[model samples]
Target: MKLTRPLLILLAIVVLAGGYFYFADSSDDSGQSNLLVSVKEGPLLVTIHASGELQAKRSEKIKGPDGLRSVGLYRVTIEDLIPEGTVVKEGDYVASLDKTELDEKIKESQTEIDKIETQLDQIRIDTAIEMRGLRDQLINLKFSLEDKKLSMELSKYEPQAIQKQAQLDMEKSEREYAQLENKLILTREKSIAKVGEIDASYRQQEHKLNRLLGFQKKMTIMAPKDGMVIYIRNWNGKRGPGSQISGWDATVAELPDLSEMMTMAYINEVDISKVMPGQNARITVDAFPGKEFQGLVVTKANIGEQIRNYDTKVFEVIVILQEQDSLLRPAMTTGISITVDSIGTCLQIPLEAIQSDSLSFVFKKTRTGFIKQEVVTGPSTDIDISIALGLSKNDMVSLNAPSHADDLEFVYLDQDEKRQMIQELENALTRRIKAQQVIARSVKQENLQSKDTGGSTFIIF
Candidate 1:
């Protein structure tokens, strides 16, 4: 029994130690296996795809009333219009501006003119009454002066005291008469000046009223030239009924010369370097599936601008269609594929499989386990890297740093091969910079701000 007890205790200790080691090794290997991913080999075609809309290559603006801002209105609503796509000739009615605001303003101006007229009449009457009163007072003074003069003469035959009093009264009357004459002259001049001031105000108000009346007549817009009417577009949508036209953006509609059409596309700064003038493009209209149109890249902007709702800056790219189709129309959304460049059948792998500092390497699988295998990389996209050297299609790479990867030695290339690979990468980067500069100079000549490039989606293969 003693022998059996000791033997059983030792056996239990051995079994427990074995199980502990087994679980510890299993957990380590499981972690390493999870980080491993296989290398892939295939053709790498880098195609830049962008979304855009069709716009008229050239169009004549069908404008709202000229000088809306001059008439004290910054914006006015389109109250009525002939349906879009209607053919019309010069001098035919196209649209009518809403007269509600204009009518209110006209009413205010007319009221002001009438008020000035009334004020002018009141001044004239008041001046007449005042002048009549002044003249009567002057006449009374004149008669008093004559009587006082006669009295002084008659008193000369009476007493000396009576003559002196009569003389004093006559002088006082003469001074009063002279002062009254001077006052009449000044009053007449003042009345004329007051009337002139009021008359000037009245004339100004009359001119304003006249202008408003003339503008009212022009509120009914007429076509300036002969063509089919196409409603103008804004941030919201096509400017139709109820859309407000402003003095700054006074355009109401357009007469598009539909003989030609072009697409306005927005390409991100990352891919703009790949695009240039005369590059072939394939465009598909969203309104119709399976129908395709061929176009050429006519322009590519060098500078980037902000697009609504996108976080990245994008450059404008213009694509001109080669042929006109009956189904083609303005403002149609299109999908554009511009073949920028392609790398033929080559090896590629997920970008996450590679890591770098001063040197680039991968956690490559080996017969023993995993090792840090130094690799030479080619051009890369946002998500994948092309393999130039140090890995094969059959080889597997770790997506993340495997367990103890920091301690593993790298399977590096020879010094000569490594130096050559570094030279190649530096040259590629230099070439890319020069190409981008060329694209910038080519498309920087024109300002294509008239078209709105929004709601864009992008893809690169």
Candidate 2:
């Protein structure tokens, strides 16, 4: 064994040749195996992906000041707000509104009130001076009447003509005095009416100003009870800093009860048909990665709507979480995988192995080469498709079209056999539909009961 140098050199060349041939042969077999994949037997899931947002099942609405319209304010902007999901006690400051517009209104109202007060004072002064002048005229008229009466008496002892003139003068003075007395009474009544009118205007302006002042205090909203703040959503967007609140819809935010929660998702119209109540789902919170929770579809929209910047229509779907967690927060984004259908242990294959034109078929491997196999297919995912019939666990199929596969022979099920397989598939689908119907009925009943029990459900988008 410890022999000559020539013998050792010959052994080295032989060993190198053997390794190169063995590796070459092994690689050829490995490539062949990679092309031919076996029919797998296991569970296959056909799922749909949708994004969701966490929401509370029940919540109390926090509103801006009531009777905003009564103060002539059409709208107000939220100037400041605490970050959403912040916990606080009752009567805590939650948000503040921009009072600049309201303050301007108050200033205008006060100015009007001042104008009314000035008018009132002017009326009082003018009335006092006019009444004094009228009274002085009445007193002078009375003195003239007395003098006319004495003149008439003196004339009585003179000529008849002079006596007649004195009687006329006395009569004239008496009539003048009576007319002045009536005019004085009317003037006093007019002055009282003017004062009342101006005073009424002053009171009205003062009342308006007072209401504006009171409303200004309420512009600072407070939490009605103890809970975390969740902003209310509207067409414009969620109620937050710089968002406008209309007089009619003054809701600012919400205090949600986190004991019960749900995830709201919008499903594309294409995938909506597969979604229904009672179907199970897996939900993952975007905020908390690597954690998943179980859920069930509780509600689906009857109609579809156009979303902003979306190319296709989407239907709203509501899924209720089965468990509660302390880290769950409202409005948190989540990833939802709704399991629309689940097949039990069955034969499955890669989708690439399957090809179709007028009929669905696969290129299955045979003793000599590959052949076209017409298969009855079932539910499928993006990567794999389930075989309802025509393939089994022992079969092998090509992942890609084999070279010169057209020259190969085809193995197809006869019409009767194909129809029978389709019939079986129909029956299974019918069973699943009936089962879903039963689940739907139960979900409906639960919804009705929840309504009777007064549970709230709302979504922003």
Candidate 3:
């Protein structure tokens, strides 16, 4: 079994040749998998992606009064939306609470007031009649006194017998006249006192009735400012009842300034420390695509708290938009990207360029073929990753390449398909634009008609 030295050497040579061929073939397959991409110069932006909402910069969320007495039996119903962007004047009826019960109360109070007024008038008439009788009695008393005096004088000039009889007659007449005078004076004083008491009572009742009427007026809810009406629902999610209910703190409606707005965002504790006042942000709403609004971080919460689904503590952040849009409204969901840090004119690449396991690499197009070049990367955002080293501007790299494609046929067909998809998308966009224009025109015509009918109309763009 032991071979000669020359034979052993020959065998080793054959094995080595076979091993080389296998290695070369494997290397070729690996090389074919490499992707080709292109690099370009652009501004690099680093942002933190956070889902937020589009809210008024200074919204007033009105809550109904907390006590049971403040709520009436009648429930308020929303007859209309008040057209989101309509301008309102002061003291306008933003929304109405059902005032049937309150209105009835007012009528009842008014009736009582009227009845009291009539009783007061009757009291005055009675007093006037009593005064007239007193006046007549006083006149008779004065005449009796004068007649007695005259008789006494005549008796003094006549004989003694006639003097005694005249004196008795004068005394009797004097007593009768004094009694009449005292009775008349007492009756007049009593009548005067009764009139004063009745007047005070009537005034007190009038004040009480007036206060009740005023309280009833509170049921007719009126707008505090010139703004749009927004309905408020309870935490339980019920809006309003069909009929008036006695005990619910449901906020029927509110008026808010449509021009001004602010956004509220919750930052988790991990990222809260990086957030600060005056930070720049970009706001995007789900309802509006291809549109971004400029916003500034106006506030950062000093404390953290837990809410609904999030287990970690969250700090509130308020963002103010530079301009107000008609489409923006309270509670409209939005996505906010806070620019934590950004460097201008920095070299960057798509986030997909970086591979997993903290290793970053890009395919560099060289004279021979696309080669895998190792790269050093820094912080990465959702869209782009910062290139720290190993990549220069104007380098051509592959976006996505098939490593297993033996020929260019597959690549050509893929490119054609991509173009067709893009064309379809463009056609769809054109149709959407046309449809939107038709809707816009219809809205415009409706607004004009509303104006002619002396009502308000709102159009959101």
Candidate 4:
């Protein structure tokens, strides 16, 4: 078509202005629509959730003798240890300690005992020899006394002076014999006491050696019950760099009975009060998806432990598993949902559906539109809340406020206005459905027309 330059420029401007206005209006209408949700009626459970790991409720700790218990012996080393994760029976060997120290101590004690016994034998021999010599001296003194006595009797018939001298000699012999007899008795008693002392010391050394031998036999540790062996890690304290645990610091491992399992959950002080013993709980092991186990809170800590490298404090809570599973293992991570409270049936809604506190409100949908309705709420959880009043089943509510709500006045709606709005909404929806139908019809008609015309036409704005 032929056209002037000024007219062509005016036409381009008009087309560009029309296109801009159309696109701008479409963009405005394309802004986010209101998100709506429905108030529901169902079972609402208020739960306190925590994360923890599985542990044995009744487990035995494998530990070596520590200070004072070791009886002043040097650190004992593990000569042989059973591998971790081995299932063991009662009285089965778990590990063995080096017995070289005990053997050396026993030998030393035996040597000491031998030395004492040798001294005791020598004392016995010397005492016997000394006692024999003392007896011989006593016998000789008695014989001399008898001879003096006989001499005194014969001198009585000889002369008065000679008889007196013989009597003096007899008296001297009698005194010497008495003195020899007393010395013999004292020597025997001293020898007996000395022998008894040496024998007592020898027995004491033997007893000590026997005790050491017993301990040496005890060097091999045995399992007290049937359970799985779990090697302990960083017990009493952490291992030094590039060094193994000494017997003094060694905690060998644990024998946990897998039959009875419990969860060791740490709850922060904020939520700790809400958890209590005998509370019903549901546990989900991370290792097994979609499987849940039931449990009860069995224990709670009175004191809180400081979190590692953090300022927070957490109290340990034990949840006893009601059912045992073969797949459940100690130290496996688990998700615990403790049902602190539960109600059979109630009106509930998403947590986001309710607004405000003290006097709560929800935007409930009427047949017309949404209205700010006052609501009474009860216990709530992270996702669902129980509506005690001011709501009913099948009630729809807006999850968010309307875009134009700030511009509109929040006036109380009269009965007539509510009815009018409901009618308007219904009419609008009906019109939308009709419009869709008309478009479908138009497309069908166009197809027929194109078939009749055997061609098509394009209209551009």
Compare the candidates by lDDT and give the number of the best one.
2
Q: Give lDDT tens digits, candidate 4, residues 1-461.
A: 45688899999999998755533222112374566666889887778888988876555766554441444465666677787778999889888777777788888998999899889889988988888988888888888889999999899788899999999999999998888888888888888888889888988888787778777767777887788987653313322222233544455567777888888777888888766566778999999999999987765678898856436898877777999998888778999998766667788898998888444677765644456777656668999998766678877777777555444323233556555645654664466446534442442111110111213422110
User: Which order, best to worst by lDDT?
Assistant: 2, 1, 4, 3
RMSD of 4: 21.6
- Candidate 3 RMSD to the real structure: 16.8
Please list the C-alpha lDDT of all candidates, in the order they appear.
Answer: 0.79, 0.83, 0.60, 0.70
Scored by Cα lDDT, where does model 4 land? 0.70
Candidate 2, which segments miss by more than 4 Å at Cα? 1-34, 148-179, 233-238, 444-461
RMSD list, candidates in order: 14.0, 7.6, 16.8, 21.6
Index of the highest-TM-score prediction: 2
lDDT of 3 by residue, 82-112 (tens): 4444456766654445555556655766776
Poorest lDDT segment (10 consecutive residues) of candidate 2: 445-454
Q: What shift in Å separates residue 312 of candidate 2 from its native position after superposition?
A: 1.3
Clashing pairs in 4: none
Instruction: Write model 1 residue lDDT over 1-461, tens digit each, in one string.
Output: 98999999999999998754533233245454435556787766555888988877777787777788887899999999899889899999999999998899889988988888888889899989999999999999988999998898889799888888999999999999899899999999999999899888888878877888898888888988888888877557788999988887777788777788888889988788778676668999999999999887877676799988667999988888887887777888999988564556668888888899788898876656678888888876656788888898967776777677678878888889878977986786677557745653555344333532322322111
Predicted candidate 1, C-alpha RMSD? 14.0
What C-alpha lDDT does candidate 1 achieve relative to the native structure?
0.79
**lDDT by residue for model 2 (166-213), tens:** 999999988988998898899899999999998888888898998999
